[model samples]
Every structure is written in C-alpha cells, then in structure tokens.
Target: MFKILFQLLAISAAFVLTAPVNNSTTGISKLNSQQYNVVPFGHVDLDDYLSNSTTFANHTYLSAPGSQNGLERRGSVHACQGSFTKKLCITGSNAANLVGALCHSISVALEIQSGNHNCADTGVHSVSDQTQGTVYYKYKTTGKGCTTTAEPGTIEGALHKFIKEKNQDKICDFVCIRLTHGGNWSGYVGLGTSQDAVKYSRCDHEIGSWSACVNGDKGDR
Candidate 1:
C-alpha cells in the first residue's frame, strides 16, 4: 500500500541522514507478549534536540515484561527469529509509555547474562522519563517540568499514531527513535540504574509483563 511504501521511504531516509550503527542484530531476541507490559506514549518532538545524529539500535533488552493493551493499546511479543536478533521479541501499542519503551535508555533493561549491567539508550525512550522521572510526559507538555507523577493516558498521551513502530522486521526491538539534534536542544539520556536507592517511580503500575523497574525484570522463563 502507499502508506507502507511511505514508511519504508522514511526509514530509508533515516538511515541516509545518519551514519549507521552496528545494528547487526545477530543475537537479538524478544520476550513473549506476556513478558512486556503495554504502555502509553506520545510523539515527543526532539526537533533539533541532540548535538549530533544518534541511533539506539543494535542493543539487547535483557529485562522487559509482558505487555497488555491496558490503555487501549494492541499487539504482542513473539519469536524474533526474522528480526534483527535471536532473542524474544515484542510488538504492542503503549500501555505505560516510558515505563515500557523509554526504560531502555536509562539502564532499566538489563544486558543479557551481564546481571550487573543495566541497559542504556542514547535516544528519548527511557532517557527522558528515566532522567525526568514519570512526570516528563505530562509536565513537558504542560510546561510544568516533571513536578508530579504522570497521569493515566494512552501512548503519546493516548492520542494514537504518534509512537510508530521503528523496527520489527529488521530488528527485534519494535520501538525506536532516531534524531539529529544540534546542541541547541536541551535533553540528555538519563543514566539512572534500577538498582538505585529509588524505585522506577510508579513503574509498579504494570500494564503487562516487562517489569517497569530499572532492575525489575528477572526472566520469567
């Protein structure tokens, strides 16, 4: 369909605009739907945000939970054999936004086998919320700046069609966000770890399976 073609062109353009990372997805695997929790998310315009072009691909998410269509979301996890890797896979809408996808940026997801290492993302996913806490989604929009907890909503504020599936066929990680900022933008990937003295705020509000906490997921298998 025309829509699909446009998306392909866009993805291709994304690669052309930025230098490609390893993205060699050889060992990639995704958890089943029961492992990752559904989340709410929205389009965060990192318009000219970063100081350079960055892509958070080719990384493995070792600690995700089962996802559920809590906030009216959809999709499920499966075998990511055809994906960019060989691990369990995910495919769902947002049930808790940053609690689900963004966690990858802040060391929320652990690296396989390396029980001591939490995952880190260079993009917005987990960085924004992990750094700003659970309030960024609403606070940023309201100009309040993470003053309180995030209210219940859909992915992209429950608006729909904002958080597009970045990688699925070529990558097991179904969500991705690529950006080319020029330093003028003022956002940084939060380097927080789940093992910190503090919890992942309200990550306890599991929308599905993947533990919302930084050090939460421990493999249900």
Candidate 2:
C-alpha cells in the first residue's frame, strides 16, 4: 500500500510540473505585446511635405485700444503667399517637430486601442471637438526637448479614458498638432488631409484603425 501511494504522488507531481503555463491572468501576450517603431523625421522638403493647401485670407482690421489712447486704430495685415498653406509656411522649423509629434500621437493612439496603457507622456497633448469629430494634440515639454524618448508602455491614462467615453465612430477626422518653442509660443502644422499623414509615415496598415477612429467610417454597414 505504501509503495502504491508513493507512486501515485510522484505521478501527480509530474503532471503539475508538465502542465502548460497560463499567461491569461498575467496579461502578457503577443496581441498586446507588439512594439511600435518610432523614427525621427529627417531633412524633408517643405515643398513636398503638404498636399492640398489654402491661402490665408488677407484682411485689414482695427487694432484693439492700447494704453496710448482709448480709440481703436486701423491696421493692415498681409497674408502669406505660395502653394503651401499659410499655417505651414509660418511654422518654420516647428514643422519638422510637428511631424515627429504626430507620429508619436499615432503610436500612442494605437497602443491605447490595443488595450495597452495610454502613452500620454509621449509629449502629445490632445483636445477633442465631438461636434465636428476633430481632435488636436499639442506637443510640449521642459528639460527634455521634442526628441525625448517615450515610455515603453502607455502613460497617458487620462487621454485613453476620455477616448473610451466617446463613441468610436465619432472620432475626429483630423488629429492636428501644435508645436511649441521656448516653452510658451507655438505654431500649427496643418497637413491637407489625414491621408497626408498616412503618406508621410508610410504606416497605413498600422494606423488603419486609428484613421477610422479619427475619421468616421462611411462604408455601408
């Protein structure tokens, strides 16, 4: 009897040891483990950077009252010229920075959608307009320049939290970026269409879901 009992115990131990390891509870899997390849923007021609662009409306307006007098003064404002949009023309060096920032934003959005943490600390800040399905994210940071590294996992929980509260189909059509310089002033990098971003990054498949989330899917259900 003693010999039989020992044999049974040994078999049970072997079974426990040979059983496959379960990772479901730990939450580490290939589906959620995909890595994002983030690359910096090199020297890009400003001419080929944007697609469709509109000219800034030239206008003349009265200046606000200044300390000099309580009367409003007339002023003339001249708009930027060229095939490129006025906004991009005014951005200067910040244009390249905006491109980098946009790439980071897309990566964060992808991670969040994939059930990963929000990568907020990636220096991509966002503001959403549910009415128009438009969202904008500004990139700014201190100590670390725009080239700072993003955390491996998501760090912007609030951003993801906000995204979750909204209807996926109503997501913004354009994810605009506002690049900051000197910690105070900033400029807008307006690319013609979200497709411009797709072309620039060459990550169409990677950003496919995010594109749908930004620009509502108009396909037949």
Candidate 3:
C-alpha cells in the first residue's frame, strides 16, 4: 500500500512540474497570434488619442498582403487618433523587428526636427532616383504664419549634432514630416532596406502633399 501511494504522489508531482504555465499572470504570452505582432508607433501614445468614454472602437487588424507563407506571417495595426482626427497605421512581419524599426524611424524624425538639416537632406535624397525617396515638408496652417529663413546648412549642423548626441546611425532610408494647424508637428523616419525605404518615402510624400493641400497649406517641394 505504501509503495503504491508513493508512486501516485510522484506522478502527481511530475504532472504539476510539466504543466504549462499561465502566461496571463506572468505577462509573457507566446507570440503565436497574428494580433500580437502588430503594435502602435513607439513615439505616439495611442491611448491618449482614444477616448475613455467610448469602447475604443477605432482600431482594426488586417492581414498583410504577401504573407501567405506560414513562416513569414505579417499583420498591421490601423488606428485613428480621435482627438487629432488623424489616422495612423503600422505593419510588420514580426513584432520585435517592427518595434525596433519604429524606434529607429522615430529617432530619425526627431533628429531631423532638432535642426539637423544635413542628416535630413541625406535621408530625403538618399535613393538613386530623384523622383524616389524625395523628402519634403508641408505647411498645415494657412496665410504663412511663420516665414523662417531657409537655413538648410544650419539645419544640417543641428542634425549632425543630434546624431552624435543620440548615438544614432547615420544612414536613413525613409523620412516624413507632418505639420498641424495648431503648429504641432510630427515625423516618421524609417531605416528599412533601400527598396522598402524608397517605397515608404514616396508614399509619405504623396500623402503629405495631399494633406497639406486639403488643409489650404502650401506644399514644400
């Protein structure tokens, strides 16, 4: 009887040790779900854009095209900033890679805005084709409220200082600038591969132009 009882207890201990842990409590869930891989841009606080009174209904998840392959799964997070009335989207093949890419991109944007014109210029004109990867600014407000001098050289110096101070990589593949009617501004800087960067840059430029025109602001070429 004693031997049998001891065996049963040992089996129970093995089961307890081998059972899967509850990730909900540990906060380290497996990254198997498609939704888990998609996230908001790092610099922007998406929650701040959402309303607490509402049920947070302005977000969606969509599968990325060409992610049919099992190993290369891709997903995107589409969200709207209710307060600003702006839409933001982010996509990635993997969550970790996407976060890293966003960090690098936002860092570049901040560096450029800090008066680093040279770095911003290089990123704006890095692609081989002039038509491709062209970076430009768009004014959001009308009537030319600000007529600052075009200090490209001074801006370049500031950008260089930003890179040195921030320890950022010199190479950039994509850049975007957004100006709001309230004088608030934002940018997206991406360090994707040459091909991906050019694509994103072109798209951002077009979108920026459209937004500026719609808001009665001049588009910077």
Top lDDT model: 3
Candidate number of the best TM-score: 3
Q: Ranking by TM-score, best first?
A: 3, 1, 2
lDDT of 1 by residue, 93-195 (tens): 3324433433322222212212322122222122223232321111111112212121112111211122222222111222221111122221111111221
lDDT tens digits by residue: candidate 3, 30-121: 33333212211111111122111222122222222212222111111111111111122122222223233233333333444444323132
| Superposed Cα deviation of residue 64, candidate 2 (Å) | 21
- Poorest lDDT segment (10 consecutive residues) of candidate 1: 212-221
Predicted structure 1: lDDT: 0.22
Stretches off by above 4 angstroms in model 3 are: 1-95, 108-112, 115-120, 124-181, 184-205, 208-221
Candidate 1, superposed: residue stretches over 4 Å from native: 1-45, 48-83, 94-163, 169-221
- The whole-model lDDT of each prediction reads 0.22, 0.24, 0.25
Backbone clashes in each candidate structure, one number apiece? Answer: 48, 6, 5
State the lDDT of candidate 2 residue by residue for 133-213, as single tens digits.
Answer: 223332222233223222212122212211222222122223222222122222222222222221232221122121111
Q: Arrange candidates by lDDT, highest first: which order?
A: 3, 2, 1
Candidate scoring better on lDDT of 1 and 2? 2
Off by over 4 Å in 2: 1-105, 108-145, 155-159, 166-169, 177-221
